[model samples]
Target: MKNRLLRFYLYFILYLSPALAFAQADVPAGARAAALGNASVTLPDLWSLHNNVAGIANLQQAHFGAYVENRFSMRELTTVALLAAIPTAKYGSYGLSFSRFGDELYSQQHAGLGVAHKLGQFSLGAKLDIWQIAAEGYGSQKAMALSVGGQAEIIPDLYFGAYAYNLNQAKLAAFEDERLPTIMKAGLSYRPYHKLLLVAETEKNIDYNATFKAGIEYQLLQNKFILRTGFQSLTNRATFGAGFIARHLLVDYAFGSTTLLGTSHHLSVSYLFSRRQAS
Candidate 1:
């Protein structure tokens, strides 16, 4: 059974390798960068739903967030996420989160459920994913995937993390014969002061493209307000953006401009609920 599962995974990877290559051919240029740049790093509140999953595991309280973005004035994207962390009697700490991503035009939906367990200085996490794509006049397909991640404390105030997404190599549909892209990401975060943090991440896809992102955050008004800024690079395009946080609410906005796409804008908002012990 294990060998059979392994063979299936290998075949899935082989089949999806070309899809990533095809996706790289057109090079959307600044689509992802414009939307995700300069967002939060740790519990970034609003953009965390799409930026990184490990960030959600660091939350001290239960949190829920919803966001919407307009892409190039052509499509609308929306997301909702819920996250919680609770102390356990023998397991140290446990974290859970669920997120959904959807677009209007093509009716693409991506949903994920994640769990993490903290052990001393190390943390492990895994995610189950469901993806679907459908259109008004076309057939719709769905797939199942998995993602695994880990985070470790490298120093007193610094941490490192790595994650592999879409590890299952699941097919989008039985008839479509296309596979979802697989991606790997690694990042580091540091806190220089009590209320300031710096983060950087590098990601690579099977499609042969690499991305580098960096951001910083500062707290103000006794932790009631926060400000953030960052930059990222994809191919030859550059993106920058900022965010604001007030108490349990957060708002983020980013802009990307390239010789190809001209200029694009993205905005997201989220709210964190009060901390509660898990039942």
Candidate 2:
């Protein structure tokens, strides 16, 4: 059974994943982003290190987060990640992130250092990533890539965000100009009420068709609990999730389903510590 599953996974990677570009590099990191259909370009949170680095410019406290995801209920397809952010009241924010996906047969790793700075109502950020791709019995390849992002408050309660992954178009292999996936995303987020949030985004891969996504989130009990739901167009997936907050800790879980790949489960935990005082 394991062998068959691994083979299927290989086939999916080679044939289908290109069409679902999100499966490749720059994958969504946290459970919150997954639960929200990846409409996270405008969201400001820890996972922003992987989504839109600029979003982290809003952080006023130090944060640490860990995340895991089991794709299609397969251990071989699991992904694990760790992230940390430090904010300097006068200098802006800095972050570190690492994530690994897949099993021994095939795997990908990303380690990145990022920085973000706020300029009045607008924020800008960038990350330098060290990436490694490995396949059993075939060795591994390493490369570096740069990513940049920006976010701005367009109005009192609305935000606009955009990011470009692999801005330098780093090469993965020498053959046929084979390179890491380059993707672009833009989105809007609106907070019509203190407790209600709505998001919509469009993503494009240089080699694939554009995709649309949207999500909604609601907070209850004075911000102690949260509920979220979202949809993706091209992938035809629906996602649901909830979050709980206790003091400085946050826990989130998400469930996503698709006709092609079955169901996936995602979970994450984050802790906030020490707010930076304005200088």
Candidate 3:
């Protein structure tokens, strides 16, 4: 019975992957980003390397992060991610991020290099990624993709962003007869009150219905702690999360649930060479 279920799961993921050209990744970006219902294109931090490259400009010092997520409480479905970034006043910010999903039976890994630069109130960024997909019985394949993003501060506390991933629609493998999805995203983030933030975004893909995401984060205890909640339209899921900060160390936790997919839990830890300033 377990064998049958595993086979079914593997085939399901494969169908959603190369065959359909869906851009959804098995490993999500980060717990904090996930908590924002993955409406992270405008949010910045060390993990922005995987979320939105332009947001990496928010980093003022070197940063490192580790993240993990469990989907439906399955070990083989767990995801692990690592990220690092260095920001310099002269050259802007540079980042490297990697993530691995699944076991040997069916696994995928992503390695990415990204850079972001800020000019006045505008930020521009780009990234190159290598994706490796392996199936125990099927042949493994590798592909490279490129992404670019930009963000502008319309007002002091309001920001607008645009991002596109796999912009060239890279082919998975010629024999596979599939092309990567070209996903375009746009969003705005606003801070109505000193301690409250709100974000909304829309994502479009050629093969899938457009998705709308919205999230809110509130700071408590003078930026040492936080609370977040959000919702996604396509999956009809709600998410809740919190963050704790101590000196240069950070910890984040998130929980998400859908009608059909049960629940997912995520945790992330990160460190910044210099602490962020409070809003």
Candidate 4:
């Protein structure tokens, strides 16, 4: 088992190297749309598992969510995520999350298990991701990756975060090398009041260009409905989304336009399980 794991890691590193080496190549324009434009990453639900693992650590309850993104001129992307957190006397709190990303033609699934420990005024966390990819005409492959992230309270209502993904790569198939994309991201979030959140994030990928995202979330109707909007520079697009929460369930939808293509839409649903009664 040890040897097999080692070999898998090796292959993963090999496959990913090419993409990094040729990082300058113009990546498929459509793929970029599928990536940064994903609204699920910013939503305050199970979908946050893949958007920012650190967000899941802050969740007050266990939640599960599924999302589907329809990208113009490309295959559909589907994702499902689960998040859970528990507080402990000795460890502060710990969180677990899992997510999958795939399309009809080719699919990639990522299962992540994570833990967060609060240190002083900051929270630190790490995630281990099990990755599997399947191609319609080719055999399936599996690999492993690791990520570390942290969130710090800069002030009473301001927070800062940083995360690194795919620090290590594992081999998944013979003669077919696939290396995970290494990414570094930093963001600042501010809660001016109880009902509003403003966020701005910048991300850098070893294999692609950098992008900036800014979003705002507002609550209405005594916190029963939420509205969100954001703009991304790399894709030169604006996104508008809304969410409805009733009891322990939340449903969200986002709409945006792509410069190179047409419009795109995303839908997500989440169920939250709280030990204590929800407010």
Candidate 5:
């Protein structure tokens, strides 16, 4: 029976998967970031609420965004996220983010509130995150994590960024030292021309091998249309994406492929409440 098979699959994952290796569980969101192979620490966008919190400081207008990603064409591996950013006159930017991964059989959810302050060419940010894990048969576990990030424009057209996720090493369970993934990332972004941008970054998780990523983006039609491509060393995945930007609304889509995981698709949409003019 289909229902019988589904139940068996759930039991297999819940009991056997963790023992093999506990997942990092820090799912990345946003088609733009995915299109760029996740080399996004320095890129500034609405979804920066999930990438580098400090990157939101670059926004001058209020923004709201929604994102969805389907990995390996599996509904159970899909991720959905909602994000918002509000910029102030004297203060910096405030951000809120919510994301969920997996289906009812198993899932992880995150809710976070963050603020980023821009100080001249440098910006700093911190977020308080509540993480929860739930399973169909088992109950749920919740913990708090702290994330911090900073971005700096080193020179004209060059920028640097770094972020620390789950710096406090929040615990998931007392047995087997089960805990949330703690990750650190640092990267650089360079723009030689207004139309072309390049990014490279390295990420390290205490429990896994370091991952290196790089991406290239080009804009056409005066930034109304954009094209992007990227590669990740961790999974040997190649990603391609494109974006269409109107006056207030932006839409982006990404496609990625790997020999092991088949393929993945990501799509995101965002709206800017108002455009900020130069003072």
Candidate 6:
């Protein structure tokens, strides 16, 4: 009977859900970004590969991370991702990331290879992504998506970023006819002092209205601990998150509230293979 119900649910989404919307790619993977209301498009973290592929091109060290988010207490809707980024001496930085959503009954996944190069104060990056959708007894579909992004420092402590996803308007589902949503994003990050950072972003998806977001991060305890908070206009959600960075380890958690979807919790852990030196 459980299998029967699961099959029925799959059929329902296969036919009806596309009319609603689809963005397995938009699920937030970085907990710090979630805490900041999915405003990480311009943040300087390797995990930003999930939000904006170019955001991590400037990272100086090799980093690996894993994270998960549970939405409204539904395990099937939970999102999980693993990411890694390495900086090469001459070729710029390279990143590999994979993200999955849903359960055995239905699922979506993305595997991507990304590269970024820094030219003076400006950084340019691009990601090539393979997207897949699968459902039990219904087979699967695969397609490729492309994204390009760039970021630059307007001054010593202020930065701007922009990226576009699904430039080809890729389609998903082997049997069903559906197209991946193309999205565009732009944002800014400002540092008023050594320990405080502020961010604002705007994102537009082809199928929906534009979203506006803002976030702030503050470093404490000599950069050992961090506090973060942010807000989003799309869902009227507010988020808060905190982080603990000790030597080579990183731990992060985020919580956000919304009206219809209730609340979401995100957690992530990362390690820096070559920890940054103290300033």
Q: How does each model score on TM-score?
A: 0.72, 0.95, 0.92, 0.75, 0.93, 0.91
lDDT tens readout by residue for model 4, 233-252:
87798877887889987777
Clashes of each: 0, 0, 0, 12, 0, 0
Ten residues in sequence with the least summed lDDT for candidate 6: 19-28
- The sequence of per-residue lDDT tens digits that candidate 2 reaches over residues 59-165 is 98899999999988877778999999998878889999999987777788989999999999999999999999887776888889899999999999999999999
How do the residues 135-197 of candidate 1 rate in per-residue lDDT, one tens digit apiece? Answer: 444567777778777777888988887777678777765555567677777888788998987
Extract clashing residue pairs from model 5.
Answer: none
RMSD of 3: 2.9
Q: How many clashing residue pairs, candidate 4?
A: 12
Candidate 1, superposed: residue stretches over 4 Å from native: 1-51, 76-105, 173-177, 235-237, 277-279
Ranking by TM-score: 2, 5, 3, 6, 4, 1
All candidates' lDDT scores? 0.55, 0.89, 0.83, 0.60, 0.87, 0.84
Badly placed stretches (over 4 Å) of model 5 are 1-24, 276-279
Model 6 per-residue lDDT tens digits across residues 116-184: 888988888899988887877878888899988888899989999888988988987544657887899
lDDT by residue for model 3 (81-159), tens: 9999988877789999988887767777888999999998988999998888777777777888899998889989999
Clashing pairs in 3: none
Model 6 accuracy (lDDT, Cα): 0.84
**Best-to-worst lDDT order:** 2, 5, 6, 3, 4, 1
State in Å the error of residue 95, model 6.
Answer: 0.7
